[model samples]
Target: MIKFFRKIRQKLLSENKFSKYLIYAIGEIILVMIGILLALQVNNWNEYRKQGQKEIVNLKAIKNDLQHDLNTEFIPGISYYSKKNKDLSRLRDFYLNKEIIPRDSLLKYFRNNWGEWHIILNKGAFENLKSTGIDIISNDSLRTKISSLYSNGYPEIENRVNIVKQFYDNEFGPILYDNIILYDSTHSHDDFDDLKNRKQIGNRIIQHYYLRTWLFERSELVKSKVELLIGDIDKEIERLDK
Candidate 1:
């Protein structure tokens, strides 16, 4: 092609037709520019396609993390706390009414009532997205929601769980350890509720119960948000597939 264009240029110049040669030279320049533009366009298209595939992979990774969380952490944790909260409520009510229940029942509640709420979120995919660039997600609304869930939602729930755990460990745990005569989960221990700080213990149990209740609700909230995000990611992946 280069040789062909050079031959044409030489012929045009040899013919002494300066005007025609000028026109030919201009046309050749235009052709070269067009070829450069087309090559650039193709390169850009390939890059775009590569980024699109990467986005889909990231989305799938995030979805997997969310699913694993629901299966292993969120669902089980929520159920555990839910049931534990109920037990705490009953124990609280029993304490309040000063009703003397069975020794085993009282000992059991005293032994296991102080529950801890802890949350650990899977942030691998999210961190990868952040390193690349959040805008890589493509969908404006989906990107925003993803960012909110990772940056704000997960952290907020984690912080709340920590606070609840701290309340249990620092306040309720000490009281039970000091006052309860013999508290054991597996072994049968002598149960006598004749503790010196009965009133203080009851109040602490009540306070811890409320905090655990709130923690349960917070865990449920985060789980629901994660479910919705998983659904959104599925929809986005479907759209991308086409």
Candidate 2:
């Protein structure tokens, strides 16, 4: 193509067709400019198409991750309820009925560990979303559903956390430590209820037992919220498929 253009220029100059040559040169320049512009436009279109595909894949992965977390962590996490109930039953049998102190410790490690772990799915997932900025151009329905899911779900989770926090601060913390102390000390199964009736022991037991009950209920509430979030993701995935 360059050779062709050069030959044309040489002929034009040799023939001394100055005005005609100027018009031809201008036309060639315009054609070249248009071709370059078209190539650039196609390149941009290809890049955008690739980005769109990536966004869809990322969204699907995020949806799956949320679903797995709901099933694995949220529900089983609340299984502490059944565990705690069993412990309580054993305690009742030993102290109230058998009048024998069991040697094993009876505490739900789940609720205790729950207070230690800081869980906010939004943090990591939202970071991924923000990094991609794909949600900016997502389908309107998908965007709306995502927004509603986070909004509706996060607040409930936060409320549950707050309730649990209050339980921990007012009831669980001191009582658990006191219970540990009693466990280590000379207190026996015979002193179970009466120990609570004592000025020092009674206050701690009342708080501990009350918080234990509340902890189980709060676990259920969190589980419900997580289930809702899973449903929200399912709806969004349906939208994506469409």
| Cα-based lDDT at residue 56, candidate 2 | 63
In candidate 1, position 17 carries an lDDT of: 85
lDDT by residue (tens digit), candidate 1, 1-242: 89999998899889898999999999989999999999999999999889889999999999999999889889988988887777777778877885555656776676557556476779998998899888889999999988898888888878878888888889988888786655354323323445413788888888988887777887788899999999999999998877
Clash pairs of candidate 2?
196-202
Provide the lDDT at 177 for model 1: 78
* Poorest lDDT segment (10 consecutive residues) of candidate 1: 187-196
lDDT (Cα, tens digit) per residue for candidate 2, span 99-147:
4443334333312322322234444564577677746436676666555
Clashing pairs in 1: none
Candidate 1 ranges beyond 4 A from true positions: 17-20, 98-104, 112-117, 181-197
Q: Which one wins on TM-score? A: 1
lDDT of each prediction vs. the true structure? 0.82, 0.58
Q: Model 1, residue 46: displacement in angstroms? A: 1.8
